[model samples]
Target: MISRRHLLATGAALGSAAGLAACGSGTPGQTADDAKKSEAGTPTVTIQFWMGKLTTGEDAWYKKIVKQFNEAQDAVKVELTQVPGDAWEQKLKAAQAAGKAPDMYIGVGNNVSVQVGNGELADMSDLLPAESWDDLTETAADLVTVDGKKYAYPMLFEPQTVLFYRKDMFTEAGLDPEAPPKSWAEVLEYGPKLKSKGRFGLMMGVTGADFGWQSWGWQRNVAGHLPISDDWATAKADDPAYEKLATFYRDLYSQEIVARQALGPANDSSAFGQNKAAMMVQGSWGISQILDEFDNLADKVGVAPLPTHDGTGTVPVTIGNMKWMIDGKSKNPQAAADFIKWAIAGDDPAVLLDYFKTTGYSKFPARTSVTEAVASAPDADTLNPWRKVIADVVMPAAALEPQYDWTVAEAFGKAMEKCMRGDDIPKTLGAVNTEIQGIIDKLKLAEKAPQ
Candidate 1:
């Protein structure tokens, strides 16, 4: 769910906390040889941790955590490295090839299969205590497991997209502001009414169609995490759900219910923010952006679960943004795993809380306890309302991102673009299906399936 906005520096939303409050501590004995008292009698282990690119706010906040981590524990010192998010894959590949990977890294969920497929990560089942592992949201927890062996520590998660709407627009349109559209049918029904007010009713992302795919995939009741077949050898592009989605977009476009700007180069949420659109489905990150850029309209904005087909239920499409993993070749695997567990869900809620708050409540901590702690904070009500939507609705419905190669997702995006432009849905999907299945075949996906 790292969007273009997250990468670009907006003025710092939440600055780093001055200091961290002690909340809890991990069991002492599990430290193992990850650190030992030097001849100087000081116990210290240098944890080499690499994180993807960060916004100014994220960088400042993370450095504070590293500072606090060093101050709070005498046994572990994290040597933080910031890698450009775009270059992470190439950097990781080169490092692995050169036999000098870092101890741990922050990476995307989609890269899990590739990393595990290439033997880049270490088994973490023993390092992250079972109880600690259990505390993670099940969907996030599922992403790190390969072949039934846990390979990464779940960190931040966000629903790939959520329903963001202007309550004022609904009220202006004589609709219930408290009750947003609950289904695609409702969206179609309300869209024109809102459009009459000189606003586009719906705004779907057309940039890469990732948001569109997520929304459609959920409605079709496709398992959110895995868009392809269970065996990872076929793309289910031809499923009936895709056609319905394409048709929906076409109808919205034809009726002028969807913003024309959304079909252009503008960011998906831009139309909504500019008051030209009543609603758009975007990542939780969009909520903060709106609040920061348009403070006066902050109270008018609201978030709801991504609408389902008939408002009956929703399939989880919450995606793992970034996860922490230990390198298989690390000399300090234990220290690396311990660092992730401690920094994320360990006994301290303050550090994790600081992390999320600093991101302006964009990152959803994967650990249930941390999530609840943030939800109940003193200023919880003061933050964006979407935090509640994320906690109450999105997390509960979160589905695992379908396991497939990144290329498959890109291909699906291209197919969706073609469908939106009036191409035959079935034909486009069929071609996409063949293209993706061909990828699976050429890559020997069956052989790569987690064993």
Candidate 2:
């Protein structure tokens, strides 16, 4: 599962820090002494790299890659540091203030937008080969590009929400295990039938904060636009579509289809694995957790795209991915770029293929070549049977996560929670409009909205 603490930090803390100007700090202490010539008289460049600790074997995979890169060359050396997720923002901020930030660091999902706005990321177009940029899928390219300048090298892509259902429970409830709900109305129709003693029909985020970011894709799916106007000048939460969307949540909560007390956070798969819920809406990363912690139920778990509002079109999903970026103020940007190229965008697909394998195929590759390599792997189907559904149905329907301030999303989330608690829908949404308008005006967001 994706780290909730890490995501929370990115949305809350980093979002608040995006307005600061880029610091003109000197290189870190470690790189200061590494400018000396090596034994052969060739100059050696030392660059620091930082990444967050992950529950997946990604930390070990990154370490192994760093070791291999260090041993295979002498022109450049990478010093790696693994920071805890919750501490990442604070540590990085401290380093930036001291002019000791790492030359390269991993970029969290939508946090890249904030970083780009702060001018903290360097353009990779000049550092890497043109083919490296061309290798990215169109969607991946669009995600890393802002104002036509590429800023990041994406590593992986994951759809934010997918439906995971228990086949055994469906069978016991006299429902067809082969056919799951394809629409929100069908989900409500199916929920009561699937519920039994000590179990809920569905599990999802019911609180305000959780609802804020988690429901991003759902908002687009239902309302056809986000809470803000296209020009980012006005609030659009008062749209009638939102009232329809709010009513759906109210029905789900009032009917007790979803428990008032959640079994766990929406990201956690333990509740589903232990049979507390027959159906769950979670990210693709949860598949890895299920295979690792509940291997016995792997066969019984089924994956599909989240249901749509009217069941007539593709359900929009939020795409979340990690990327590697160079610090704009780094003294050794070329060295850092070379390392990223060798590890992820190199001609040889072996390194990236191994990452997907090590992560149990839970994440999808960003490059077309890597995707092709993965499809042709020796044991592709045996590793994960749901890969086809995710790669085809879910991924093709995904939209990039919104890059606006988290505060805007929080206002809508609070409104959603109030609606679920049986508050006046018109009054709740009017408050959302006022709150978001204040944010837009205070931040001067209209002037900064993407052209």
Candidate 3:
């Protein structure tokens, strides 16, 4: 798999050498064909749908859903294709370049803006029924909206890095397990207490110093547009809050409050699962992972809102939510829309319940009714806690990744790495801010949203 840094570098080099070619013809969606019919004699339409790869049986579950939808319907026949996550972007680009894009494909973070800007994704604001659109959670609906139009419909929401701590560890440290730290200052204060028990207070990045920390700061709802200016033109790498965040992590490393392994490629959850770390910030999906892998530790683990700078509030940051979008060049637009409506926003409790169960309750549906149903179901005890966390903590104050440019995020990540290495924090951030601004100018990101 290509690292995002390498992908951005390749895009820049290619841009300088030849420029990105416009892909796809402005073709209209195909209408139902009379050439093919089901046993009932209704005209049939086959729509091509593509999704990214998943290992945890979600791939099979999606395929099963498609088969069920096909069997239950006569007007539409869906063709499903699973694309590897690493290659999905390249494949979509290639197909779009050749004017053969699939009817529907999954849209990930920041790509929604990129594709919408390039006119590669279909306008979905008025495509689905208004009720369907209204059913989406505010954050899910807002994430796909670019220039006041919805381009994609969210299927699931996986908020990143809600604070997961060990109740046993908290009790051992003479702290109240019922009351987790409410602010970053409290988290830092707990470090020494946890360290006395031979455990780190928190483990954030474990493998390449991922972007979780950035989201930590963004969720604080710091006074200004984070990592970017309000206009979305200038890089805000030099923002005081960003510098403070980087410095805080640097201090954590220097003080040995956080293990060095977490800064590397080791999964932090493993450390948490093994009781090596007293606390760590992880996605909602990690709850199922810890439960499934280490059932013995189930009662010991606890989930809460990730700490803010001053306990102001918490906001949900997108972790692994998948958004479905219609391809701009799709031939079966209405058929594809119909299928999405049925699968996602449809008022079918049985189907939605099965979808929630099929993924082991790792995915949270974006539809309010589905979420409520799952929470009320007596057999869904494993997921009921998470539903409360999502409702009370995550969704109410949700915010998006900077969305201006992926490179901005990459640049900030590099700056954080330099800080972790004990480099001059101010100088490193200053240089990165200037460099990112240069990239923004070169890509004309200020004039248009970037990929």
Using TM-score, give the best candidate's number. 2
Question: Once superposed on the true structure, which residue ranges of model 1 sit more than 4 Å away at CA?
Answer: 1-48, 54-57, 71-77, 81-102, 129-131, 172-175, 189-200, 208-216, 222-227, 233-235, 254-276, 291-294, 357-364, 375-378, 381-384, 447-451
In angstroms, how far off is 66's CA in candidate 2? 2.2
Would you list the clashing residue pairs of candidate 2? none
Task: Pick the winner on lDDT between candidates 1 and 3.
Answer: 1
TM-score of predicted model 1? 0.75
**Model 3: CA > 4 A from native:** 1-46, 55-57, 83-101, 125-127, 147-149, 171-175, 189-201, 206-209, 212-224, 259-271, 274-276, 310-320, 357-364, 371-382, 449-451
> Mind giving the per-residue lDDT tens digits that candidate 2 earns over 376-438?
997766878888898889988888887788889888998998998899998899889999999
Q: What lDDT does the true structure give each of the candidates? A: 0.68, 0.81, 0.67
Q: Highest lDDT: which candidate?
A: 2
Q: What lDDT does candidate 1 reach at residue 30?
A: 24
Model 2 — TM-score against the truth? 0.85
From the highest TM-score down, the ranking of the candidates is 2, 3, 1
Candidate 3, 142-191: lDDT as tens digits: 77888888888888777666788888989989999888888767888887
Candidate 1 lDDT, 1-451, residue by residue in tens? 1111221122211110101122332223323232234223354457788887655667766776677656554555688888876688799789889998888888766567677777788888886667778888776777787767888877787677778888998998899999988887898899999885656887776544454345534534543334467677667777766777667767776777876545432223555777877887777767656755665887888788887765777646646577888888887677666556556746556657876776678668878888887777877656655676677767777765656567777777777767776788889889988988888888877677654
Residue 152, candidate 3: C-alpha displacement in angstroms: 1.6
